[model samples]
Target: MSAHTTASGSTWAPSSRKPPLRARLLRASWRGLPAKRHDIGWEPGLVVPAADGSPLVTDHYFPRAEGDFPTLLVRSPYGRGLPWSPMYGVLFAEQGFHVVLQSCRGTGGSGGTFHLWRNESSDAQATVAWLREQPWFDGKLGTVGPSYLGYVQWALAREAPPELKAMAVQVGLHDPYALFYEDGALRLDNSLAVGAGMTYQHQGTGPFLRAMLRLRRRVRTAVGTRPLRDGYAPALGGGIPWLDEVLAHPDARDAYWQGADPGEAAARRTVPTSLVTGWHDALVDQAFVQYARLRAAGCETALLVGPWDHTSALQQGWPEVFTESLAWLRAHLCADPSGLRPTDVRIHVGGGQGTWRDLDAWPGQPAVTSWFPASGGYLTRQPPTDSAPLASFRYDPADPTPSVGGPLLSGAAGSRDNTALEAREDVLTFTGPPLSEPVEVVGPVSAHLRVHADTGYADVFTRLCDVDPQGRSVNVCDGLGRLRPQDGRTARLTVPMSATAHRFAAGHRIRWQISGGAHPRYAPHPGTDAARVDATEFTPVRLTLHADSALLLPQGAEDGQEVTAAP
Candidate 1:
């Protein structure tokens, strides 16, 4: 082993070295190896220093009678010991690969401060360089993790390190812009939920700390407070400071986001990647964008999307996520072509029985299906040939529309019932009759709206829902688009809803919801379009939705098969 002094004057060990006994055993316990599985030995707190002299904490598990073997690297800000090391580490190590779970800088027992994803690429490269020098490393490294853990892999893959082999990323964020703020709207609930965790984790774990971190309550307070800046910073305790940094730049065009984008990182990735996410995962849109970019870049990639939200994605999926990932990792990392795995894009269709379907390519080049707004509150296949009437609504920001369901991380997330939400006066509903035949809308859905607002600015929220036999409006996918005063005389709004494989059953009705807001799903548009934006106090804006406004669905669309229209 060799050591070199960093600029910060600490001697950096380039190989696994014994950590203090207390540090090694703290919160780390061993479970007996599974019968007939590889008997693995554990080493906790194997400190690897980053280039800047920050100690990065890592735990390693290896087969008892091991020679040099391939390594599975999982880099995360979450603590590296116990739960993850036991759940993932032992499993991978049992499969004949060494598993190393490392806490990112400033997390667990590591040194320096964790600044979300800012330092992951460099820290990961440094770890790999150190891992290569270790006596047991066989020059092959595969990465796995869900959410933030998975994100670190993408960030590091951009470097194209020689030792890096394969990646299995589940429900990870590639585009910070999309993850944080989508189309100039703050993803209030999700952002604050993550911020709350980052805040509590940064502070030392204690009963008081846990009390302070009562994240759900804090997020509720944050959502209720106005102007966002006033609420999020103070409530989150100024730890995990990047929350404010992201809030500072609400748009993707901001230069602050360029470095963290997965689109840019995709161009540099050379490894075979397995992309797993849920139809309702907040970052599902980013997942599709990432898959397309990787394929266009000619990198070997696989995609699996299911009908699940962020938390549920960890466990639920049609083919089972962990097993599919294991098969993928084994195929690429161990060079074992497991024929049990499907080699095409797979998605679980909603509103139907949970059955997995494989497609040679993604849902590409589907026919454009249009649903136009007609008399009363109905969505029809036939366009209005007569004088088009306008539907009007008053948008009161103080009493904004509430979010009931869909792809959110916090506060009523997932496909929850929206029957009560649709009955609100501020919400405009355009419901279609029962489908005579099942319609499979298996790709991106968009809304084209022609609107004129009496106020300077307004926000448009659109949702696709499946109205079941008992009159339950279950959300499928939704999107929000902000209409600024500078837009034009008549705003032509295009809101791109998330992608989904949903089969509208023969008896189910297709419903489209148009609302002024989705509450903290988006920070309620302050009903203003001034040089200085404010959401605390808002004006009542009269918004008119022209009959030209239409909802666009994917291929295999139905025409002239409508019956009842409900207001």
Candidate 2:
């Protein structure tokens, strides 16, 4: 293990072994990383432009051995100093290629101030260019990551640099506005955390930090007296619509969003790519659409959807996920023994069914069965003969439903059903009868519903769960919809259900939950002034489930594709 520091300008030799920059960067990183039999580590490179025309920081850990290793470049807004890169970094590197992690222009030891994703594209492009110039680099490159880290890949891809051979983006911020706001409404929780966290991370983090602190205190005071039912947004009381600041633009073609379309031009090039997502992932649609678009454009792109939530990609069950991803990368950037052109797609079987299957493509030729909503908290095969007394719940923006783990949280903590989160009243639950035959639902999941709100604008959150005989509602997948729904055409939109391939056993039940909001999972849509009432006012919304509403199944798709089985 060798260590080299470019700090204030100094490069070192480790134990008399002189390695090239690429090997040095990765080896340095690997040496310091926590080691595990299943884990891999290495040093690579980071290219940062210095203010005084010197060097910024240029040592990284690309994931493969030196000598023409295909590269996977990751440029993160977070500190590369953090363990996240080393943890996921080395694994990808050892997957038969080079993996590189670099601190963004301003974060960590890299020189510069972080302006969110604004200036990241150039740094990423430069880093890729630098990587291509290395003796150990093979010139083939791809990018992968989630959230802010994922956002960087997309930002750089818009430029479509020559060396960005391909990418595998998860839960990325395609449209900052869509991610942050809902029709001018801000996601108070995300706003608080993001603004607060960044402020704390910055030097003096300045006014943003001070203001968020004060607002937090006010919010606590507001929610303190109200029953947990009054809701929690205004209670936090802060200024500047962080959501408004970012999500003001919802159109996909908007210059701001289109300029940095993470999907980039992978389709136009012969870039072989793969997309990773969870059934309950909020960004499922973004990645799904991108994967579809890339594939349609003749790029050798594959899609892999699982039942795990946001962070589950790193759990004990992630081996299969990584396996397929490695195979995909290996086929494209490394080596492939199978004459197969990297089996087109892969998905885990749904309904507690474990195993992976391959297919010619997504939404495969599958027999789609519809499960309609019944009157008495039941989701049945037959549409209700009588419109059961419409169940109603008070959706107070202040105390909306809290997220208890799911893809919507991007695998954030509350995603799984390990704890008893279903006990809350705000969460409306619907369960299906035990299965008579094993049913495997694969591919993307979607919720089709006719929604109505007393207010002009609204937010719809949905979750699909696997209920064991023990009555344990283990969340399987979830999706969110922010609606103004002013146009009748837009209200009937088909959103990608969190992608999953699960098999329901002979007796397990399927559950679907609909609620107004999921904190942190998404921001709340605080009813406008047009709606009356305040502390006592709760917006009552009635959502109608139509018999025609059905989950599309890619029937006949067997999980034998060149993909990995999900946990």
Of the candidates shown, which would achieve the greatest lDDT relative to the real structure?
1
Q: How would you encode candidate 1's per-residue C-alpha lDDT over 1-567 as one tens digit per residue?
A: 444343334443343434334433531443332232565656777899886879988888766542455788988776754346555766666667778888888877789977866898889889888887776777788888887887888888888687787888888777777777767888877787777655554344462256355655576676777665777765666645687687777767778877876555645565888888888888888788878888888888888887788877754342366666776787877787763244457767667664566666677667878998876899899886743546878888777788888887653668888989888888889989899988888789999998887875888899999999899988999999878778863688899987878889999999999988887787877777531123557677877788888999995422212112100
Off by over 4 Å in 2: 1-47, 50-56, 61-71, 88-100, 129-147, 166-178, 181-244, 247-258, 317-326, 334-342, 384-389, 409-428, 455-457, 482-496, 529-567
Clashing pairs for predicted structure model 1, backbone only: none
- TM-score, every prediction: 0.88, 0.72
Minimal lDDT window, size 10, model 2? 30-39
Q: How many backbone clashes does candidate 2 have?
A: 60
Instruction: List per-prediction Cα lDDT, in the order shown.
Output: 0.74, 0.56
Q: Tell me the spans in candidate 1 whose CA falls farther than 4 Å from its real position.
A: 1-36, 201-213, 237-240, 317-319, 386-389, 530-535, 556-567
Candidate 2 lDDT at 392 equals 52
Model 2, global lDDT = 0.56
- Worst ten in a row by lDDT for model 1: 558-567
